[model samples]
Target: MKHQATPYFTFNGNAGEALDYYKQIFHGEVINLQTFGEADFETPEEMDQRVMHAQFKKDALFFMVSDSFTDQNVKTGSNIALVLECESTDEIQTYYDRLKNDGNVLMELQDTFWGATYAKVKDPYGITWDLNYTKEQ
Candidate 1:
């Protein structure tokens, strides 16, 4: 139930470009990446290549970026998220529903072949988030 500090960026519709720009500006590498169609989340063709999730690291700093998937009115803002790496499905769903109420649900909880219960949302204040429950070995 503990949350780790993470930076989440919600782009109006230019996540890919913005991420790449940041990578270049910071001289960091995009460590992890996920796209809309690449995962369970649906994406419009125009947004397919856009970043669903991307992490850039420059030393100890982690930066995440994603395109708009909530269908809500998106705007510019400098905000961050504290990601939750939950321990179970029930926990994941409970967190998802609770956060979805006052935030933007970008991804509904789904069981992935990668063996994780995962979802993403942006709280009312424009802060993005991600939740995960990894499958046990």
Candidate 2:
């Protein structure tokens, strides 16, 4: 199974601005910018304009970013999460089982509107992980 770990940054409500700033600084382009309002699932009215997800790419360098949806604001030290792009369902399940053993399951593994199996977990070490496995279409 293939595994790619990418840095995912979370902003309180300024993810769009942050993405734009990064794009300018790194001379990258923001690809696939999807806002909460654009998602197939329902979102809070306040989150309608917030970024649900976006990718910044400059050649080989890439990262993901989104605005937080929780009641808590994004803290300085806890705004980053590691995203693991799994190649298969088995791969994601195995990782999820292992990671959640001594960790907190922030979001359980389940099919998403984006056509992928996704989950979020915070390990004992306090590092958050976002695991996603998209089926080939």
Candidate 3:
């Protein structure tokens, strides 16, 4: 299966500003910008304006950014993660199994409201990973 890695940045609560800053600096298009309030998922009232997810794309350079959930805190050293987009369910499972072998499972691999099989894990070396496989319609 084809696998692609994208850098994901997590901010405490200034994801929108970060996204805007990156767009301005890179002259890239910020697409798929969604706020916690915009999504159908449940969130605290205070998190309504927080960025749930957003992407910045300029030519071949692409990455994602989002605000941490209300219950979580984002610190500088642990704010970045690698998003592995897999091509199939098995592919995701395979990688998840390998990565979580001696790692911590931040989020168990499961189906998400956004129509994808997703999970988050921190490898033994402390590098976080976001594994996802979007099912076909």
Better structure of 1 and 2 per TM-score = 2
lDDT of 1 by residue, 1-137 (tens): 74565667777667778877887898988877888768675557766776677888899877677777766656656434567889788888998998899998877878776678889888897666788898897
On the 0 to 100 scale, the lDDT of residue 55 in model 2 is 95
Q: How close is candidate 1 to the true structure, as a TM-score?
A: 0.66
Estimate every model's Cα lDDT from 0 to 1: 0.76, 0.93, 0.91
Encode model 3's per-residue lDDT on 1-137: one tens digit a residue. 45468999999999998888888999999999999998887888999999999999999999999999957778898999999889999889999999889999999999998999999999999999999899998
Reference-based lDDT, residue 85, model 2:
90
**Residue by residue across 45-120, what tens digits does model 2's lDDT show?**
9899999999999999989999998778789989999999998999999999999999999999999999999999
Any runs in candidate 1 off by more than 4 Å, and if so which? 1-3, 40-42, 70-73, 78-80, 90-109, 112-114, 119-129
The TM-score of candidate 3 is: 0.94
Q: So what's the TM-score on candidate 2?
A: 0.96
The pairs that clash in candidate 3 are none
Residue pairs clashing, model 1: none
Lowest summed lDDT window (length 10), candidate 2: 1-10
Q: Which stretches of candidate 3 lie over 4 Å from their true place?
A: 1-3
